[model samples]
Target: MTPNDTKPSAVTVRGLVKHYGETRALDGVDLEVREGTVMGVLGPNGAGKTTLVRILSTLLTPDAGHATVAGYDVVRQPRQLRRVIGLTGQYASVDEKLPGWENLYLIGRLLDLPRKEARARADELLERFSLTEAARRPARTYSGGMRRRLDLAASMIGRPAVLYLDEPTTGLDPRTRNEVWDEVKAMVGDGVTVLLTTQYMEEAEQLASELTVVDRGKVIANGAVEELKAKVGGRTLRVRPADPLQLRPLAGMLDELGITGLAATTVDTGTGSLLVPVLSDEQLTAAVGAVTARGITISSITTELPSLDEVFLSLTGHRASAPQDARPADSREEVAV
Candidate 1:
């Protein structure tokens, strides 16, 4: 590969559209990913997120659109495009009967690597992914996290210029998810452009340099995480009174602060609180003052910015934890609660 081959814009899409019978999976979507940045495509279950990734990764052709991967047009230059992009779908694709090392070596050989080179790459990846200890074990015996790491290693056999990860950490525990996140960060540091599709807000917030949110086959919002959060209204004020009996007074004070719709609910076991969504930082401060003036001691008072889940709900008229089948084909299923 020449220096020009290392240049960016590894994935680009314009006016992309795809359909399944009467449902339009992608409707006039446009996206651009820089050479080395991680771009997140986020949406609820039905929100065309997978469809878009599928088109850009060359797994599926678009009905009416144009895309390019590493300067090769997806439709006209698919063979060349395949050489530069790596795609890991929602499920792991490794052969369970093969040992971890064997799986990696096989992929390397399939990529046309010399036998010696393939073995070397396999050893390197096993060590890099902390799988060297289990390198000889059948992949089916590996834990979910380990299997995911091996799957990722397989995708790198060709040293792809761009990587597409569809919900890479969907079923792993928190520790394993963080491990995968670290690997993604390392990839970005090494100058590989990544396009990630995930419903997890934390995943997007932690990994993506930019986010594009799809709803009903259209881009409902797109920007940096903070910028997207800002568009969803304002800060939220949460106050927990030391005495559960004081809830009524706290509610009244919140109402006096011009914050209507104040509601009381148990925050957790042995904790009672009132939550009111406020529109501004000023409202938060004023509400705090009024609560103090009422002689109610505040057990805790905090202001929180709207989360990505909140943004999704506000834009799509449904909570993130709602059923997937309830959403339109172009819409995303709510993020898991």
Candidate 2:
């Protein structure tokens, strides 16, 4: 069985709602994160992604609805809930004044770990996160990736059953991002249920088994990765011309082949590529042959299922990671929290 099919929900949210004055941060959002798996909450800025994380993390009281993390009510049993949940927001919240090892040890102590156990845990995490060599150096001396890893280590110091990661890999390089992804997979392997909120489609696809997409304070879509991809016309032939300006013409040419659904959805302006539904190998071969026959040069060509970005755009009329006022909503969310 898939993760969502068999495991009970580690977290459950029913009719969740939160408003910031005139702005509806969350509008009756319903969600579930299966035990020992990652539930990706995907959305753009100002879409209330942070609001949902705040409520579930017990940092903010919802205006309406009920949520339970690890069987503890967010509002009614916040202290109990806090014991089982760990949060890592978009930016690292580590103490730059402290060394890496000290940060983990301090958080461990704060969680009531015994002095010996805290020290042991700190040593273990520093080694695990590849910070052992620089454990004694102040956090401000570490690289961006190092700082992020240190922050991640700090969150796991409590061995919490459920972790809330709110856009945790927002501004990292691809290598560092992959490192974080590996760490997330390792957490699930250890049976830690994770609620990951991110606006990056690639990140959502890489880490999450299932996704809940929030837009304008509502869950517009929620399903397995493949299920969401299927909704936006699955297995599309991504045809990118040598010249971006030729995209419309390429679509027109593809439509001439009479592929039933090719005409309606063609140009993904965001990527400047045409996505033609791939129904069968024979159809794809025919389409490729036609393009070659017409002598239309292509910069790239591939047949793949719909990406999470397309699925997201099809569900909500916005790009998942478009440029925006850098984390303004997040700052406001922290204030609200």
Candidate 3:
């Protein structure tokens, strides 16, 4: 069964509303994060993605509706709720002056672990995150990736049942981002329920078992990654012309094919490439035939399912601005975490 098919939501929200004076940050939103799974909240800046995380983590109160984490009411039982949740914000929240080991150990002690146990846990996490050799060095000397891992390790001191990750990989490099993704997968394997808000579509595609896409403070779409992708009009047939001038010509040829549902969606990137939405093998075959018959030399041809970026564009009427082409996360390799 899929993650969403699991019973007993680790988090639940209903008609959650939060307003900043005349501006509504959250417009009667609702969401569910199933037990032992990652629920991705995907949106652009000012989409209220962080607001949702804040409410579920007991950092903010909704003006209307209710929310619960691990069966503890966020507003009514915040103290008890805090006991079961962990939060990692967009930026690293580590103490730069302290060594990585000391940072995590201090958190363990603050959580009331005994001195010996805190020391042991710190050692264990240092090794787990491959920071053992650098454990004694001050955090400011650590790399960006190392600092992120250290911050995550600090959050785990409590071994929270629910973890709130608010854009945890925002400014990290691809390798560092992959490391964080691996850590997230590890936590879910250990039965930690995760609620992650991110502007990276590939990040959501990589980590979330299911996604809730929010725009203007309301849920615009919710489903598994593939289910959401299917909403972008299915597989897209793409062609790169050998001659740069052939790009628009190829698009015109496809438009002249008179195929149903083909002309209106064709996109010319104005860079010797054409993207056409094709639903079936028949439509794909026809497009290829028409282009070749017109003597348009093709550099390369490919057909791919719609990406999360396309899905986001379709739902929100704008593409989520992401760094580095916004390609699929699966196309890249992860740093050994």
RMSD of each: 6.0, 5.1, 6.7
What shift in Å separates residue 297 of candidate 1 from its native position after superposition?
8.4
Tens digit per residue, CA lDDT, model 1, 1-337: 3232345666778899888788888899988787888889887777898888777777788999888888998888888887788888666789999999999999888878899999999999899889999999999999888988998988887888899998787667788889999998998898899999887778888999888988868888877777788888777677788888887666765666554443332243254767766776666666777777888888988877788888877877766642131223333233211
Which ranges of candidate 1 are over 4 A from the true structure?
1-8, 238-251, 257-276, 280-302, 321-337
Cα-based TM-score, every candidate: 0.81, 0.82, 0.82
Candidate 3 clashes between residue pairs 3 or more apart in a chain or in different chains: none
lDDT against the true structure, each candidate: 0.79, 0.84, 0.85
- lDDT tens digits, residue span 1-337, model 3: 7646857889989999998787788998999889998999988777888888888888788899988889999999999888789999877899999999999999989888899999999999899888999999999999889999998988888889999998888778899999999999999999999999887888988999999999888999998898888765668777888887777667776787798666444656665568888887788888888777787678988888888888888899878867552345453312100
Position 195, candidate 3: lDDT: 93
Whole-model lDDT for model 2 versus the true structure? 0.84
lDDT of 2 at 241: 83
